[model samples]
Target chain A: MCRMCDWLGEGQIWYKNPKLHANRMYKLREPGRKPQESLRGNIVGSNLHEALEAKANGDLATFNRLIAEKNAADARKVGAQPIPLNEAIEVIKTLQMPVAAMMCICRKATRAEEETNLNEYSCLALGTGMFKWERWPERYRGGVEFLKPQDACDWLEYWDKRGMMHLIMEEGNDFLGGICNCDYPDCNPIRQRVDYGLDQQLVKGEYICEVDFKRCNGCGECLGRCHFNALKFEVTIDRPSIDPMVCFGCALCQTACNRGAINLVPRSAYPALRNVW
Target chain B: MNVVINPKITVDYERCTTPFDCKRCIRICPPAVFVVYDIESHRGYEVDKKQPGTYKMLPLYRDKCTGCMKCVEVCPVDALTVKMPEEMLT
Candidate 1:
């Protein structure tokens, strides 16, 4: 991954870049049959179905353009039945407006190369939290507000097999208003998680509220930050003891410790996150 | 020729959290064989091809599959699959 360029979602227009291995790279450098292994596993379908699937994969740009041209001949408008491919692109562009407005987008993982169609190489997209809404034009209704954490877990599960899902940091995303789905090219959180190099840029929710033995002001400032009830002042040491399981890694208590007492220690990988396939 | 749900496409009901958010099969398919109801959860349910209930899970969409394996590869919980379709190839 291009560490500095990753901060930008576009990632320096790396169509010819050699590093990307999973998607485009492995397909290119490996011998014909070996490279085609991923593609060959595809199931067959009708012509119309193939055409539509091709567009979603962004594999058939000319076919999509042709369909768009044909739809224009039919003369349709927004919200009309069977929204034209061009309008679908418009809807995707519309969802992207927020990222466009904030300029908050970033590039995470890398692609080997996409064959340019009509001489325009495709710009990849990725997003997390509320940012996912902009990435999928077809999924416009923001219903994540009505969903729970398990719902988010299931949603991620759906994309995991296809290699399309990722997680967002608690600091950058709050589920109440955060997005539920993400695109490979439109999400930063997913991109960073999947990058082959450099894990530092991704935040680990470490450095939480562990009490220092020396400072026992008994002010209970740390207690106030402990929403999970993990911290309670023992009184004798002038510091709080923590209940680890109750501490869901919120990191809020770390912010409350004035004497720089509370510290979060690293542990094994998060149990809930292990299902991140 | 003979069709059985690929053994690899096992659905974990515990993880499914069904009737959940997205009918991802609908979204991912080129021509969606599965009709996902936004309001209902299809978690842990199986499609009986013989009876063929009105609330149907998608068939293989086998006809439309390009052998892409993208579907099989991307399943979060291994809810879908594609295997060696022996008859036609041989």
Candidate 2:
């Protein structure tokens, strides 16, 4: 955030002459004219079938963790270094890579097409905790002066040793490998309209992050943190009204769960709004 | 030059937030005046060119106008209120 603030402080938000009354040029291209960006899918350069089978058979457990382990291992074998996440973020912005959630593994996430049935799993990490990673001390040690191009590769190298830095998917694909991780929400090939608040999800959410009703301790830590006006006391079925449109999927609610009641499951982004994709 | 929408002047709309980085407000204005940007929205105030050349005033005033509301019919979101030394409303 500090670095982003610095970038913002430099008066650079793609939009020129942001001040009111200033006549500036419009750079937003039409949808078709917009650059070609593929959505991410569960397509890594690894054996996804076995991984999924293990998950289905209760051997691997959550698909997210398995995908991370595999990607980390492969990244290490190929000598991919951890580019300072902050620097990597900067590079993604500079180079304009098409990614979602900064940490999207290339092939595990993508856009939902109007046609074609896909067994693919597209998940974005939406990890707010990683902001702490961006502020990690070691990343800024080199300073931009020494943040050379080679250092970019070294950054990926460092990344290979860690856990899945972004959203990971364990599945199949046709083009663009099974791993698309990095940044650039619009073009990251790993994100979709829903990842960056572009889908029909602008309406109120239905399936909100919830806790096991049985495990409710009645603590209200999550109430203040919730940006949306959802969340209710546990008494009847009125637990929390999840307005998905407002939920950025930051998972702070789950983090605050003292009784392990908050669990994120597939729920309607909004009830009234029809799914466009 | 600055595009002044005097609080007394007429503007098309209070403002328009065209989403993402839509500089529609800038494109519509005649003067190459700078619009201020809000800290979060990244849209708003610009230079008060009527005075000494420097950044001043509500730096984030632009984000306030969403280019919607009825006010836009008269005051365009691109409208600016330039305060000349003499015309400066005390």
For all candidates, the clash counts are: 37, 76
Where model 2 places Cα greater than 4 Å from the true spot, the runs are A1-208, A232-241, A244-246, A268-277, B1-90
Give the residue spans of candidate 1 off by over 4 A: A1-208, A235-238, A268-277, B1-90
Across A1-277, the per-residue lDDT of candidate 1 in tens digits comes to 2221232113541111223222332223444422312211232222433443444344556445544443333221110011112222332333331221111122111111112221211221222334444354323322113223333334333433232322221111111112213333333333322321112323222223356667645677656544334567777766578865444343445545577666555323446432211
Predicted structure 1, TM vs. truth? 0.25
TM-score of chain A of each: 0.29, 0.27
TM-score of chain B of each: 0.44, 0.25
Worst 10 residues of 2 chain A by lDDT: A108-117
- Score residue A114 of candidate 2 by CA lDDT: 13
For candidate 2, the per-residue lDDT at A13 reads 19
- Report the Cα lDDT for residue A12, model 1: 42
Structural similarity to truth (TM-score) of each candidate: 0.25, 0.27
lDDT of 1 at A28: 32
Model 2 TM-score on a 0 to 1 scale = 0.27
Model 2, A16-132: lDDT tens digits are 112210111122334444332322323356444354434333453544465565554433221111122233334333432122222222221111111111112222211122233
Q: Please give, for residues B1-90, the per-residue lDDT of candidate 1 as tens digits.
A: 312222122234344333123335444655333332222323323222223222223332233344556655655766666553454345
